[model samples]
Target: MEKRYVLEWLDRAINEFNPTQTQSANFEDHRFKSFLKEVMDETARQIAYLKKLAFQYPKKRKFQEVLDLYFSALNNLIDNARLNLKLIASESVISKKALELVLASLADIHTFLLNRYTVSINPDEPLRKYNLAVPVIDFAQPTDNILLSNHPALASLIEDEFDAVFSTGNLANITPRQAKHWKDLNDQICTPEQQNPGDEYFCSLELLLIERNFNSTKFVKYLTNRFTSHMEEYASGNSIEKLAYIQKLFNQIPVIKGLAYDLQHDDLSLTINNWFICEIEFRSRSNTGKGREAPSTATKSNGCIKKTADKVLCKLTVDQLALFFKAADQSKIIAAKSLSAIFQAVAPYLSTPYKEDISHGSLRSKSYSVEGRDEEQLLSFLTKLTRQIEEL
Candidate 1:
């Protein structure tokens, strides 16, 4: 019979006999079951013939086209089996037979294709240089357990689609550029300094920019408006007056002009307020000179202050500092929050001794003396701290 005729017959037979509608009782109907089994067996035989034609008449366009049709029919059969498997929640002899047939069909197709193509091919030769035996979906491992646990239904569909494409040789590998993009994104978000600002305003900004493509103009405006509002409240005796100067500084920046307008228009007042508070905290820490400057030597207090400054600076690298500034330009809160976290986490080791003259009144009284013997302990502590931050 003509290959086209055989292909049409297989399609008609499958469409006429809906496996999904068949129940266990339908299996006991000898005539129906026998007819269905005969059609399935014939379809498998025709598929094998088409595979032979694919290789025997490689130059014939019709032969390849018929081969493709056979594969498509085979795929439909499997898809139907999958649907029935899902619908018939309770397993029975009929469902088991359907599953066995599906697996058999898959195995037959894989064997025929591999035997003709990949099995004898040289490993060093690129797989793409040959007729691709399988699609991209086949090559990927099953979706991770995390995905399955989080989204069971979606995971099942994803797996089915993945397996179907893979079995048919339809999928491809990730491109080099795609891999690089993911790697860069992972580094930006998962790094420690990015996660914890550690008294560095810029770190937080980098985090925001990396995580969210925050609008720079909008961010600056929000910061400025928040600062101004806070300052006005402080001046009117409704809030702390110490924050007034910082708020004033924030207002002077060109970025602050339209901030209040943006906040009200966009309904981001709460977000803006939170961001402003983080920025203020970061600025406070930075200005104290404890994390940024060399400690003073005018008093016994000066030595401790200098040591703390030296410790933090020594721990910081030029790359980290650059990332910090980049983060700051994106959002002060992001930079400040990240830096504050890092500083607080590492403060036990990085803190400078409180010199009476140089110490901020509160920190001065609480400062501890670091004896020469304690240097090793401090160094060990800083080393571990650096590693922890780097991992973040």
Candidate 2:
């Protein structure tokens, strides 16, 4: 008898002799006994047939393919026998036997047929020795247009804008203003047009300022708002948690005085000028009771603004600005260095005063002092300046 048929017959005998089915009367019947004997005989015949087939295919076919075919045939026969047993036997006995058979087959395959084939190997090529140094360009040195062309943000913006125009079939309608707006947005710089109403001239001016590396505190405020808007566009669920974490870090920065948030998208941007310039102070004087009332005085102060235009202008050049931009676009280290250099050069002349009693942790010290009348005048000046920048 073949090994497969012997195993099937043994399985049937084990199931019949098992005493666990004490509740079933069918196990004691003569008809069930006759059926079990027939199953054992059939299993013996299948095992003999498999043994004959295996010995006949000793060298005529690949061992792996022959094994697969033999196993497939045996599996079909075993499955059919199991189904027949399930139909005739009690539900509990059939279920237990089926599980045992499945487990036994898995174990047999794992032990006898695992890793029957070997995988071919390929050799790897030797590593080549080549110089990988990139040419270092100093921010202090003049940079050519070729360097600017490598700026990631600028390059990406140019490509995207070009593709947008090409795809929309509106290449002819593309103007310098639109190009400028795109450039400013790519650089995280804001134009006056973006803050107020969109206009071609202001957009162009924003581009010029970015190209020139001009430090506009007012402009930064507007740019922060723009960044907030952009971040909101991509934010969704769980973004609010992220925004809260960012705000915690942002609050630690001394220069960042206030933050405006877009909750719908969890977008946040710092308003540096909002803390320094737009801060308001209020004072009141009153007499308690009517007898021997003494005169009371109230005072208000503001922040300062100073600009050193000549100092800033003297330090700036097209090449330096281009290099600054290129570096700014590539890495935060480069951007911070360039920005610090520009700010240091312009700091002496660019100190502006706040027109209110704004505190910067110094007691009894005022950067800009203003009376009631002067307060109105300063507010008007600031409003005009804001409008002018917006219209640029």
Candidate 3:
């Protein structure tokens, strides 16, 4: 059987059999095997039904041709499912290998991923419309809690997916060129601009690179150089595309977390023209609580302000700013109205001074940013919030 049919069946299974948290409570090795068998049985019935339908319409000219292709495709899927089932059954217990096979099966069948792999369905016009599938009313799809449920076990699988910090099988290799190439990529991903999917992918790669302290610096340098050239070429014509890329990147690589330290460095002053980027970076950091628990205070942060020729800027890393705001932003005792008043009181001086948006992509939150432009406003906001809460 071509890979696509199995992939299609698997994709259907994933969408059809969404086992909820409650249903997943009783999943075991036996239950997993039962699922594979169930799909195989269901598939066999669909093929038989198609065969019966085909025979009844023997007078139809294209009937045998359609049945022949449908039977072959459906049977191929059943055979593959049987092979998977056989592999599952060979082990009396669900060993690591069995679990891995199951995971691979799930990954293989994911619908979005199916589009990327080579699909060899009956490309002919007649057969293209004839889907040899029965309505699957009662199939069981396993959930995460059922298979490889524990944290440690799952972590091991994730660890296997990584070869090194930035080196994964998912991406191809590149050669290093110059420092400028690396710097541009660093800026695009690290800066506070709205990143597209491609940029987000680069950001994810950068995060992994940072996590391992760039142990594979030589290889990373090569990728940086190649990526920088690509960015230069695409930045102008494909700016809008960058937005859609991030959504796709997240879908392709869904394990990113705690972007709590992308900022908070001395790599500023060069990009002050684009201060809004810094503002975006600051809010993002604060939201993740990266700076809130730090030993820094608003009064102290304000003290770091250096008198400049025209602008009143705080001499603080992006991280320090995030922390100051996060610390001030936390006040559990304040009334909602009072808090809004306090926030409006200190809306300037902060790099990214807007209140946190009341909602996020596809979800809503009751929080907003009340951060200040610098230490002074942050302190002022904090004082007003605290004072208002005390009076209340």
Candidate 4:
């Protein structure tokens, strides 16, 4: 059979089967179960033919059209079974045989993947071995635990779909022009106030690029829906706290986390900014960027101060500042609500008489003008804090 015919056949087969047409209410009727079995059996045969045409199809679009219909058939069948779980459980023989037909079709759609050589599914434990009853019900639930626990078949299907969609068959190469496009892209995505994209914005662009490159809105829709659901459950906070909240959610959710893992495996550069993009997209999608309160004037001013402070603070390398903060926090050398508070505590110990005049905004600013002696005082403070922490 040709591709178009297979598509029509599978579409018609799945749509035509109405479990509701039975004489009995619960689908316990013997004829109804038998008819379901026949439909499943014929659907399985049609899927096999569709699979063959998909494998023969050269173009990705044509291949995808067949593949989408293929998954649709499997999903619809599972959904039908799920809707009548009680009847399925009671009629063990027909359900078992009928479900096997669906499961067999669900196994390893290798033609859908970029790397056909790389087999992710375990041959030792095939899809047919699992108790379809447990997974059929679990597949209906929208929880990650169900995907991770009893729904290996569904998880495998999603993982395979992700790999197929995102995977580059060969090493992803970029021309100089493409590289320039990425640079321009970086600028285009920047906020109006900022001429250049920061690390956070750059990360957001990369996440968007992944969505663009694959041209898959399904993943993004799934991601945003899951993200919004998770975000709704979280306690409201400031932008940074909310960013942190999103990071936590991205790492916690299986599909999001799985995509990150797959990207890493695909040799994509994974960065902290990757998680930050979720907040950016979430805000764009939500319109008002709900859940996060706007920063007060003081906080906004503090950011401006930090930007200026960073100019002088840059003299002390990022690594040095990072080590100092980590050590300080680990040692409990300073108990403070914010970075400014930590700076305030240690500012008293600095040599400058004008230390008292340093604005909290300036302290909060990562950019601060520090002279040679003041830099020494900062280093000395770090040493003192480290020793104090070491003693503890």
Model 4 residue pairs with clashes? 305-365, 306-365, 306-366, 308-367, 309-366, 309-367, 309-368, 310-366, 310-367
- RMSD in Å for candidate 1, one decimal? 20.9
lDDT at 387, model 3? 88
lDDT of 1 by residue, 201-227 (tens): 223433233133233344446445645
Better of 2 and 4 by lDDT: 4
Candidate 3, residue 313: the lDDT equals 43
- Give the alpha carbon lDDT tens digit for every residue of 27-95 in model 3: 466667777675556445444444355355666556545445544554444344444444433333433
For residues 104-211, could you state the per-residue lDDT of candidate 4 as single tens digits?
A: 443423233313312322222213222121111112222433322333443344445434432455113222222333344334333333222324322333344343
* Candidate No. with top lDDT: 1
Q: Which stretches of candidate 1 lie over 4 Å from their true place?
A: 1-25, 29-44, 55-63, 89-92, 117-392
3 or 4, which is superior by lDDT? 4
**Candidate 4 local lDDT, residue 105:** 42
Candidate 4 TM-score, C-alpha based? 0.25
Off by over 4 Å in 3: 1-215, 235-326, 331-339, 352-392
Q: How far is 261's C-alpha from truth in model 1 (Å)?
A: 49
TM-score preference between candidates 1 and 2, better one: 1
Q: Find the candidate with the highest TM-score and give its number.
A: 1
lDDT assessment of candidate 3: 0.36
Position 46, candidate 3: lDDT: 43
